[model samples]
Target: MIVVISGLIFYFVIRRIRKQIDEMAEVLEDIKNGNGNRRILSETHEIVAPLAYEMNDIITSYENRLSAFRETEENNRQLMTSLSHDVRTPLTTLIGYLDAAQKGIVTGRDKDDYIETARRKAHDLKDYIDVLFDWFKLNSDEFAITMNQVEAVELTRDILIDWIPIFEDKQIDYSIDIPEQPFRVNLDSDAYLRILNNLIQNVISHSHADKIGISLSKQNDKIAILVRDNGIGIGKEDLKHIFERLYKCDKGRSEKGSGLGLSIAYQLVEKMHGSITAESEQGRGTVFQVLFPLAD
Candidate 1:
């Protein structure tokens, strides 16, 4: 009688194990048919529980990777479309101005004006291409950052010095307040300079501001650098996407830019283990803050 009872117990255990195996097979089939969401529903005490957990983890990773691939594809499509339109439109206008001047359609001062317009449009095209190159280079795997300990205040001063003349030329009032005590950070000096230059360029080109302010301060272990402008500020909706690649506010749509400057700056900051944030109110002003941990 004991032997018979043991045989019965063995049969029941095999039957339950077979059931779980069948379920796992079904889930595999579903996944093969492109149903990435299908998962095995098995109790922790079941024979197949470990296998189920591992398979589920694999599926989750697969799904995440696939989603990322799709997003990247979409972004590439949008970038190409934007590039086509931007390049062609400016090229066409540039050709029109040059053609008018070449064909003598306008004479005297009008001809000179046409030539000047063509020159400006040419410069605009070059600027757009330069920005596009910068974006591509920064995204490429070959790009490298050479980080070293640098004095933040001195670096900021050097960067702003070049911009002083530009601010004067633009007739934009500006102030610089860098503390005498140096705050040091680990950074690629060129990348840091690019970040500052990009922010200042954005203000010069798009902010429509007459006054600008730059200040640097240290609090505890972190250093803060602020770039503020009294310009036509960003709208709430547009501000949310200002850092997105190729994003442009409605107010800046007519402006000549590849819309990649701030995005590149953001990427560079991340690579340097720093953070950047923007604050703005429409018709009031915009301020960009960059922070980094002090070098040990």
Candidate 2:
């Protein structure tokens, strides 16, 4: 009788162990089938408990990373789509204008004006292409700025001189207020020129202001440059998105712009280890403030 009782007890224990193993197997199979909700229901603390917890944690972390990656990818796709549409429209219009002129559809002063218009559109297209390429370089981590010690005052003067013809033609009154003392900054000359050119062109094309003001000064180990215009100021809502890629304000004037100027300028500023901000009130004009650290 004693031997029979011991045999019965051993049999019951073996049955319980087999049942637990079957349950664990079922849980793993559920997980394999994409049922992340399933978890092991262990009755007692054992080796499997730690493993179950680790598996759940790993799944959760993986899901979170995947979600973040999807969001980033969607945003990039939207940006690229928008950029393509915006860039293609102007290029198409420019081509149409050139074709008309070539076929003698335009004549006399109309021909001359049409040619000039085509040229401007061509320039606009080129500018858009340049901005798109630069943005792509920035996205791919291929764009780099070579920093060098540059005199802020002299640089400001040169930029002003280059833009004088445009200002004169537009009858736009402009003034440059630069300090007599040299203010040095660490920056890439090409990048800096591109930034200033974009900003000035934006003022001329979008501001519709008769007068533009530029000021350069040094303050507290940094150099500051301000570009201000007395024009139809940007609205509060528009101001927030002025620096976004392919963003344009005023649908009526959208045909005249590619909306890449401010975005490029903003990125170039960051590459130079500088900061840019804007202030504007509707009907009171806008001001762009750029600050760069002085080179050591």
Candidate 3:
């Protein structure tokens, strides 16, 4: 009688184990069929509980990575579409003006004007192409950054000096306050210059602001640089995506160029161990602040 009882207990345990295996197989099959949300569950006392929890974690991680990849792929597609439109428009204009000028469609000052327009368009196209190249290079694996310790206050002041003439030419008022004190930072000078240039260029191109202010100061162990403009400010929705590649605000800003300037700036700043942010209110203007860690 005892032998028979032991046999029955062993048989029941084997049957329960078989049922759990079958259930796990079905759940795994469903997951394999693209139901990433599916998860296997088991009681804490069950032998397979740990395996089930581990599988769930693995599936969640994989799904998250896949979702991110899909998002990046979609963004690249949109960028290509934007590239097509932005390139073709200026290119077509440039060719038409050149052709008309060559065919003598207008004479004297009119011919000169056509040639001038063609020249300007050619330059504009070159600028757009340059931005495109930068965007591609930045996204590629080979982009390199050289970092060195430098007195950033003097360097920043020197950079702004070159922009003074441009501001006057654009009829934009400027107030720059860079403390004569020096602060050390590890940065790529060329990259830093480009970052500042892109921010200022964005203001000039998109912000219809007539007044601009630049200030540099040290905050704790970080250096802060601010670019403020009294321009037609960006909307709340658009401000959130200003640093995303190929993102343009059509309602509040001019839809011009490749829309990669601010994105490139953001990436460059990050590569240099810095951060960039912006704040704006409709018709109240916008301010861009960049921060970098101060080097000892």
Give the TM-score of each candidate: 0.89, 0.74, 0.89
Candidate 3 residue-pair clash tally: 1
Residue ranges of candidate 2 with Cα displaced over 4 Å:
1-72, 250-255
Per-residue error for 24 in candidate 2, Å, reads 12
Q: Rate the local accuracy (lDDT) of all candidates.
A: 0.90, 0.82, 0.91
> For this target, which candidate reaches the highest lDDT against the unseen true structure?
3
The sequence of per-residue lDDT tens digits that candidate 2 reaches over residues 6-111 is 9998888778667767887887788778776676665456545676677668767766777788976886787677767867777788888888888999888888
Q: Clash number for every model?
A: 0, 0, 1
Clashing pairs in 2: none
lDDT by residue for model 3 (264-286), tens: 99999999999999999999999
User: lDDT (0-100) at residue 11 of candidate 2?
Assistant: 88
Q: Which lDDT tens digits does candidate 1 get at residues 1-296?
A: 99999999989999988988898899889988999989888789877789889988988898899999898789778888889998999999999999899998999999999999899889878877877888889988899999999999999999899999988988999999999998889999999988998898898889989999999999779999999999899999999998999888987433567788999999999999999999999889999999999999
* Off by more than 4 A, model 1: 1-3, 251-255
